[model samples]
Structure formats: structure tokens, C-alpha cells
Target: MGISVEDEHGDEVDRIVAAWHLERPDLDTAPMSVLSRVTRLARRLDLERRAAFADQHLEPWQFDVLSSLRRAGEPYALTPGALMNELMVSSGTTTNRIDRLEREGLVVRSPSPEDRRTVLVTLTAAGRTRVDTALIALLECETRLLSPLTPEESHRLAGLLRALLLPFERPRTAGPPRG
Candidate 1:
């Protein structure tokens, strides 16, 4: 058997898989066909996210913090501990984010109304505006990204992704994160 020629329908990963298959014929490279596309798509999406956030003068982490508070609805405040968990950052990191956002006047730290001992991170009006605007920009970019797919195809893709993600979303004995 000979190495496969580049096919018109193939993308970069297909070329890579062909090269790898020729080099290691004994190994099955089937998973690469699916996973490589997903990985590439994720990176592209992250770029779009960064561009959208940049337009709002926000970084991804800042958007993460502000969006969490915005999603909390009226008053848009959450305890620092709650923000730490929701943002999935260490308490110290959360503090640093809050400090930076506070400095920018996008958020404020105030004594919790229910428990004065606790501090709440509240989204400032500016924070709300920035996150909301950024969110709209992101969705527009994402919609364009998915424009090639039909609505049905998009729905099926979402279902497939959810199935793939379900196990990771569950609590289990912690494993080192996947690359």
C-alpha cells in the first residue's frame, strides 16, 4: 500500500492523519478525525470570544466574573466565596479579579446585607453594560461561525457535544485535567 494523496475534501487534520497512518500503520487513528476538529473549533471560538471581549474592553476572566454576577439577576451581587466557586478560581485569584474590576469601577465590594461579616461582589452598571454588550457580540460571531450548519444540524451537534461533555460535568474522583 502507498501513502494517500491529498484529497480535495480533506482539511489539515486529514493530511496529518494520513501522514501519521503512513508512519504508524499498525495504530488506529480514527479518534483523531473527530477530536482534532473539535479542538480546532474550540480554539477558533476562543479567538472569537477574545475579540468580542476586547471590543467591550474586557478580558475573558473579567467577563467570566462580571457575567456570573449579571446572571444572578436583580441586585447582581454574589458573596466572594460564591463568586470563587462559580468562577472556579482559588479564593486568592478571585480576590485579585475583584480588586482589578473594582479598580476599573466595573464592580464593587460591599458588606453583604444579610451577613455583614461577608463581602459581596456586585456588578456595577458599567459592568452590566460591558458584559451584555460583549455577550451580544459573541453570539453574533458564534452565529456566523455556525452559519454553514442547518438548524437541525446545529441542534444535533449541540446534543452530541452535551453527550460528550456529560461525564466531565459530573462529580467523580478527581483526575488531572485533559489537555
Candidate 2:
């Protein structure tokens, strides 16, 4: 396939790839063209997220926990295990986060009604308010980031990224189970 240069000016990744190509003529750096962009975009997004949450006096981890609960619908509570799964963190980390949030009066821990032995983490009113505000700020930041792209372009980009991500999202099974 022929590579087309769309614009006159190239970004940092383009420069990096050019440098690598000049340094290692035998190596193929095609993957870096896409993955480097993704990596840099992720770093920028993390900065944006931190700034948005800071405006609401929330740390990113706090926002992660609170947002998970906020998305859980009415009552806004979940087991620590559920939170761990949603946040992709370990049990000890989730426990520590819950403890800190509880101390801040953002969340409260109570016995699960369905199972007395289990504990549920419920978002306090303050937690809900903070998470709601942070979400608005986050959306605003994200919208600004996508301002360069038209809505249609953004939609198409999202679809392409999802397609690229599908392989990682699938389970490690050989194939679909037969009934």
C-alpha cells in the first residue's frame, strides 16, 4: 500500500517516526505511526482529566470510584468487589480508596441487605454532587479536544477505534459455544 502525506505540516509523532526511519533503515516503524499517536493522546487526556477533577476538588481515583457508583443508577451503591472489577484495581486498593472516601464523607459503608456478610459502598449526597460536577467538567474538556473534528468525523473515528479494540475486549475462548 502507498502511504499518502495528507498535510504540509506533520506532528511530533511524524517527526519521531521520520527520525527512527533515518536511524534504522532496515526496521519498519509503521506501527509507531498509529500507536505513538494513541500513547500521546492518552497522556494529554490524562492531563485533561486531572485538571477537570482538580476543579471539583477530586483526585482522579476518587472520581473513578464515585463515577462508578454514579453510573450504577438509583441508590448508587456497589459491593467493593464490584467496584474493584469496574475500576480494574485490586481488592486492597479498592478497600483503601473506600476507606479514604468514607473518611472524607463522600461514601459510606453499610451491610448489604441481600447478604449480611457483604458490605456495600453507597455514595453520599456530597459524593454525588462532586461526581456530577466533575463529569460536566470532564465532558467540557473532551468536547474541546474533539473540536478539531466534525461530529461525523468524530463518530467515524470512534467506530474505527472500537473496531481496533474489539480483539482485546474478547475473552480468551477458542470460539463461541455451541448449544
Candidate 3:
């Protein structure tokens, strides 16, 4: 069966529009195809996520960086390179973010005993508390958003998403783009 409006949901339309322009020369495809809708819905989900984080006084990028370390367990720390990779940003950008988080007293830098040249970025007590609170609020917001869906449906959707992500989980060589 073709993808339905209910299945697509959110901002699927905009994503389709963007893709159509990019691949139109190669194929005559409708903008509202599967990938397009998924892109648009992702955009919409991002906006909602930002608003949810905003309610906790956290920027989306801030939450991303903070949460990554928080999920690291124990001391809640990682090297700057780790943060850069997780945030998918340039080294300079990650440095800037660390600087800002440091100023806000959310994170701190300490010398790595094994490698004096490397520094570990650890979440401060305050940072951990902030992320903990933000996480609770964020989960509550998500639960409410998905309230309309039955429990079985939610579980099924999550399984479907996991299945889709499985193929991309393994490491792969970098190469030229494929159509």
C-alpha cells in the first residue's frame, strides 16, 4: 500500500518539495513521496523538540552536547573530540560551545592524566541537575504528544523505526554520493 497521510503525518510535504527539486532531472517523482514527508516531519519534530527544550532554558544544541556527556554515565565526561563528533560540528564550533557551557557553569575542563595534551569535558553538578530536570520534562512532553496513539501502535512504530535504522548502524566507508 502507498504511504497514507496518517502514516506520513507532520511536515512530510516540505521535504517532498525539497527532494523533487534536487532529483527532478533524473526522475519524475511526486514531492509528497515517502522520503519527502519523512524529511518534513523530521523538521516539524525538531521544532517541537526545540520548544520543549526551551521550556527547560536549554538550546537544542546545548541539550545535545550536555545530554551526550550525561549519558556517558558516572563523571559525565568526554573529550572535546567526542563532543565534536557527537554534535557533528567543526572543532572550532565545539570549542565555542564548550566555552559557552563553561561560562554558564554547566561544564568544566580537566587535564587527562594519561594524556596531558588532552582535556576532558565533564558535566558540572549543576549541569547534571539541569539535564536531569530537562530530561524529565522532555519525556513528559513526548508522552503527551504521543498520547493519541495506542500503546501497541507506539511500540510498533518504534520497532519499525529501529528496523529502518539498523541498516545504517554499522560503520561504512566514506564515498561519493549515490543517487
lDDT of 1 by residue, 38-60 (tens): 99999998888898888899898
lDDT of the candidates, in the order given:
0.89, 0.91, 0.81
On TM-score, the candidate that comes out on top is 2
User: Can you list the residue pairs that collide in candidate 2?
Assistant: none
lDDT of 3 by residue, 17-54 (tens): 54554656466566345556567667877888888888
Supply the global lDDT for candidate 3: 0.81
Runs in model 2 with CA error above 4 Å?
A: 1-8, 172-179
Q: Against the hidden true structure, what lDDT does model 1 obtain?
A: 0.89
Ten contiguous residues minimizing lDDT sum, candidate 1:
1-10
True-structure Cα RMSD, model 3: 5.2
The candidate that wins on lDDT is 2
Off by over 4 Å in 1: 1-5, 173-179
- Put down candidate 2 lDDT per residue, 1-179, tens digits, no spaces: 12323334788788778777777869999999999999999999999999989988999999999999999998999999999988989999999999999999999999999999999999999999999999999999999999999999999999999987877666658564333
Which candidate model has the greater TM-score, 1 or 2?
2
Looking at model 1, the pairs that clash are none
The candidates, ranked best first by lDDT, are 2, 1, 3
User: Relative to the unseen true structure, what is the C-alpha lDDT of residue 57 in candidate 2, on a scale of 0 to 100?
Assistant: 91
